[model samples]
Each structure stands twice: as structure tokens, then as C-alpha cells.
Target: MTVFRVGCPHCGGRAHLESGEVRLARTRSRTFYAFTCPDCGEPVRKPAGERIVELLTGNGVAEIGLAPR
Candidate 1:
């Protein structure tokens, strides 16, 4: 399983999440990712640039939402 190490702003800790646990949203000009913090169960969302989107998608993280016009 692919695991991503992400920082949890809620608990101020780092969490390891599987690819399935993450949601990626992308558009022509922007990209972002969201996941629930395993440590605190809080929903976390953050901006993702091109490189971040590439790395996450390359590792099998699922893409979500519609691309903007």
C-alpha cells in the first residue's frame, strides 16, 4: 500500500495515510488534497501544486471533483 506522510494541523502532528485515504482535486490553475487526520480525526485540506499533484497521483492517490472551466 502507498502511504503518504502528511502534517496534521489539528493535532500538530504528522500522520501516515494510505493512498486510498487521500482525495486529490485538480484544475487548470490549481490543485489540492484532503484527508482526515488519523491522529485527531479532523479533516485536513491543503493546496497542492503541480509537483505535489504529480507525486500523489503517480503513487495511486485517487483524484476527485471536477476541473474548473
Candidate 2:
């Protein structure tokens, strides 16, 4: 499995996470990626662009689509 490096805002620690640890959420206006920091167990979320979405999905990150209101 591919491992991704992400920084945790709550603990200020860098964590290496696998694809199973990441989640991709898509909304009408934007996309977001979320993960729990292994080092600190803090929930982290960040905005993702097309490139990021491509990369994350390619690595097997689970994705959920949000219905537009």
C-alpha cells in the first residue's frame, strides 16, 4: 500500500499514513481529504484540488460524494 505524509495540526507532527487511513469527500464546490493522525490521533482535514484528488484516489483512498443542496 502507498503511504502518504501528512502534517497534524493539533499535534504539529508529521505522520505517514496509508491509503486506508485517508478519506476523500467531494462536495458541489470543492473536494476535501481527511485523516486521523497516527502520531496524535487528531482528525485532520484539508482542501484538495484536482491533482490531489487524482493522487489520493490512485492510492486507494476511499471517496464519498456529497449531494448538492
Top model number, TM-score: 2
TM-score of 2: 0.88
Tens digit of per-residue lDDT, candidate 2, span 1-69:
999999988999997889998999988887899998888787988999999999999989999767974
Instruction: Give candidate 2 regions above 4 Å deviation.
Output: 67-69
> What is the C-alpha RMSD, rounded to one decimal, of candidate 2?
1.4
After superposing candidate 1, which stretches have Cα over 4 Å from the reference?
A: 27-29, 66-69
What digit string (tens of lDDT, one per residue) describes model 1 on residues 1-69?
899999998899897889999999877777889999888889998999878988999999999977485
* Whole-structure CA lDDT of model 1: 0.90
lDDT of 2: 0.90
On a 0 to 100 scale, what is the lDDT of residue 57 in model 2? 94
